[model samples]
Target: MQNSKLLILSSVWVEPKSSAAGGRMLQLIKFFQSIGYSIVYASTASESEFAFDLNALGIESHVVQLNDSSFDGFVSEVQPNIVLFDRFMLEEQFGWRVVQNCPDAIRILDTEDLHCLRNARKGAYKKGVLFQNEMLFTDVAKREIASIFRCDLTLMISEFEMALLENLFKVDRGLLYYLPILIENETIGKFDRRLSFSQRKDFVFIGNFLHEPNWNCVQILKNEIWPELRKCLPDANMLIYGAYPSQKILQLHNPKERFFIKGRAESAEDVIENARVLLAPIRFGAGIKGKLLEAMVYGTPTVTTAIGAEAMYGNLPWNGFIADDNQAFVASAVVLYSEEEVWKNVQQNGFEMVKERFAEHSYLYDLQTKIGYLNANLKSHRQQNFIGMLLQHHTMQSTHYMSKWIEEKNKK
Candidate 1:
């Protein structure tokens, strides 16, 4: 009943020091392995920069190169009962191969976020235009949805995306399951109201700058929003903190403007928890923003846009405020940052929300049970996904031949 062997094909190696997805995968691996499931992690990323030593965990590791025939052979040899694709991109790349070679294997796609939605929203924000449905019909949509349909099931990370997929793409509700960031119900000690916030100055914005939406938000704050906010709190500063900030992002730095770009944080938790208010005026993006979740966890209430706060607050009252228009967003940020009573209420609300939605006891237990059931019933589960089999039949003939052609070409 326990010791189920699982093969997890990741987009990158589980590098806790570098990757969020990698760290999440490691947690899942730990959970499964604890329950006696043997795990084999395979990825295309190089062995270096993989912070966690695979040998220590006793999980088998395989280095898979893209556009190669060797993968089919390797997968056929392993014959795992369940295959976990780290993200939709990985699923798009090797999903068909797994389905073709191991027809009975349960294919699970952990859609880190809806790529099509992210891509579309990014495109619109950069152009200073609004999102249009016609843009959704692009090639990414075809590939993204095809991967969703090809897999037996997909792990939906954001409730907003779950509804978007079902309503917009018409994906079967049965194929999508809610699986938010599963975190241990660790205590986020009482907010040190004296030093952390009362003494703190300025509005703070934090995110991974490599992400398009974050970079877009930086520009919005600098060119448009901050000037308005400073008018209200002229003595206050706005500190922008994030990881992997590019030179271009650093150039946004201006002492006179008081928009400080302090690069990557030594500790993400420390930066946000110490801030007076978290400001994320994200125009459009998909999935729940990790920074916002981190803010909530740190009890740092935020002032964000509709897109930034989407699906997270839900019917429950928001930790702080949601504003989209330029003037409204700036007004909300000033109020959240300066008003101690309002800030305290928002912070407490955030603490409750994280505890309610992301606590391990609520989502993880049920998810583990589902994963066990699916793994145990792999054969019958695949039978229900006839479209997966149909796709497998054709992809074996088409993609198999195409991969072979490329593999043969590489020899010359």
Candidate 2:
């Protein structure tokens, strides 16, 4: 059979080197391509200097407009076999149009992480309270869950989030697909290319500064974690690396105190491989962190909080010690940095976790099987998902008219 066409509506162009979401988007695109899908990526956001060159990868790119009729014409022309929304927001904007224009196309929502979960945790953190499920019932949750119900399948990045949707929100399992960040089988052999524990030096933290969690983490490191850690390991240096560091982030640099803020790593993996240990005192975030995953890939051990290591390891020990307590977190970092045996063991553990939890081949096969099965029995599947049908029907009428109203107003 000839391959089907896949269309992705993104909030921003993929920038793999700049952010974790970008990396995940690129991975998803490449996976579809590898499975013989003709891919086209469309977004409303302007292209940035750091955005990945989708055209260079032989994928067609289009700049779409929100609340416009032009998108209807584009969707009608493309008539994709599958439509994947990058996040719930995009799904909310264009999902109705897709349903109206190409009703047969299998609509999928890729929830990069549970935005509601992350937002709830962040809110609770700011309030100095524990995050509760009740906190998740926000306006964001309403829109995100509605998007999930409207789509044939929603890709979940974390197993934790999948369970939350099933048990807490009571979303059907068939509607949600658990597909974590996958590591290729070939990466297992690349461990040989990594620098040995002794060759690596200093503690490092890398993330996109634009992300609130990362910015909060850097503050926590500066105010709460680093002072204690520096006092303990006076000779040890902490280097912060990330893209688009704001002035506030840059101001944290103090060469006299052995804390250097190195903005924007040229190659995250290269810098990670050279680091003795990765320190991420992430206070609040969702999804698997790309930095933590990169550390494992580069054979670098890490010392992070329970929140930092959440849902990352399944039935296996962490690549390094996980401690939420600042003092203990500092102590773990000291040990991981000083002891070669401990660091080496943790590094090996990381490789094992990557192999077992994130093996690319297993996930690829699972995705292919799921897509093939859905394609063959989409009608029956849709019949079983009456709620999705209802939501789509209602969304079509409500969102459709509102979008058209805005489109008409823009012409005046």
Candidate 3:
């Protein structure tokens, strides 16, 4: 693997503080760097004020174009050993181009989370209906699943989603890899440094407001949860924190009611650590919740919905309480805030869950071994994945022409 290069195609530049996706992207970049792979991050998306400076980290950054031959030239010149699509959308947009230009490069799709599952849940929530399995068989699923099959391997962040792919969709196990968020070794030691139950106060909800689910969660808290919680503990405050707060979100802030909208937390950890209880009533979403994970790391007990806690804690006891009922949710938060012994015990449960489920050591070595093996046996690997090759051949024929047509149209 000497002189190996890993080219990452992102839809957005990394902004760790802005969202969990940004933080996850940075983690993957660092992982590639640690394994001695020269990295280049290319994106069609424009850079933001808060975007992480790739150049500062000794990683090359490129702004590439869509539906253009310029990307073909870029990929050919870079000649990356590995081409990683940041999400399935990137895969759908550029997967064919990469296959056509760089046949030898290992194609991997880093599915941030299953977008179809998220969208399906969103639709169900909006309709006030139970999410059905048939919902997963939509247009989004077709594109996403096809992208999974087209790639050599797809990285899944959640085990639940991984099972859904194999058991329901019949995606080959070899074509999917489970790669959860890697917690740092130093993070465990920081658990001792967290504020005691007495030092911390109130309930806190932190998430990226741009996420539809988060905005929905904040609305639920304001309209449904908080009013009931306040009735129980009239003095307790519920601090709503997140990045990219719009006018609509800001309007929800009422200082008299102590429902503070503290936009853009300077440090998610700092805020979570200082808070007595983290309350995230995420109604419907996919993958693991990063805020809940951070709460565990910071020793802040959380009271979240079943959907918020989904696929995170496994069979282990939750860090705090999991309640879907608004009344139960608020009751759990009030108790978690008021009782020291219960809160401390819940905090310890979080610590154990973090150590057991999310530690880097659990996955890093296995990932390295799998990648090395896959790289060594590329020819045979592709041969075994005949369906992928067939899909690539046929799907690309249509996609290839459409892209070329778009390129020509743009030239005129």
For candidate 2, give the lDDT of residue 124.
97
Cα misplacement distance, residue 84 of candidate 1 (Å) = 1.1
Instruction: Provide the clash count, candidate 1.
Output: 0
Please report the TM-score between candidate 1 and the true structure. Answer: 0.91
RMSD of 3: 1.0
Q: How do all models score by TM-score? A: 0.91, 0.98, 0.98
Write the residue-wise lDDT of candidate 2 on 355-409 in tens digits. Answer: 8888887688889899998889999999998988898899988998999999999
Greater TM-score among 1 and 3 belongs to 3
Local accuracy of candidate 1 as per-residue lDDT tens digits, 1-412: 3656789887566755343454467767887787777889898887765357887989889889888868989999888877988877888678778877887787888887888888888788778797887778778987788788888789887998888888888888877889776556545444344244576666788776667788889998999999888888888888998767899999999999889999877677677777878888888788777788878887788988888887787667788999888988888888888788998888888877877787767876777778777767767776776776676567668877787788889989
lDDT scores for all predictions? 0.79, 0.90, 0.90
Residue 164 error for model 2, in Å? 0.3
lDDT by residue (tens digit), candidate 3, 1-412: 5568999998888999988888989988888888889999999988788898889999999999999889999999999999999988898889998988999999999987899999999999999999898899999999999899999999998999999999999999999999877788888877777889888888899999889999999999999998888888887899999999999999999988889999999899888888989989998889888899989999999999888888888889998999998878888888898889999999999999999999988888888888899899999999998889998998789999999999999999
On a 0 to 100 scale, what is the lDDT of residue 77 in model 3?
A: 95
Pairs that collide, model 1: none
lDDT of 3: 0.90
- Worst window of 10 by summed lDDT in candidate 3: 185-194
Error of 2 at 399 (Å): 0.8
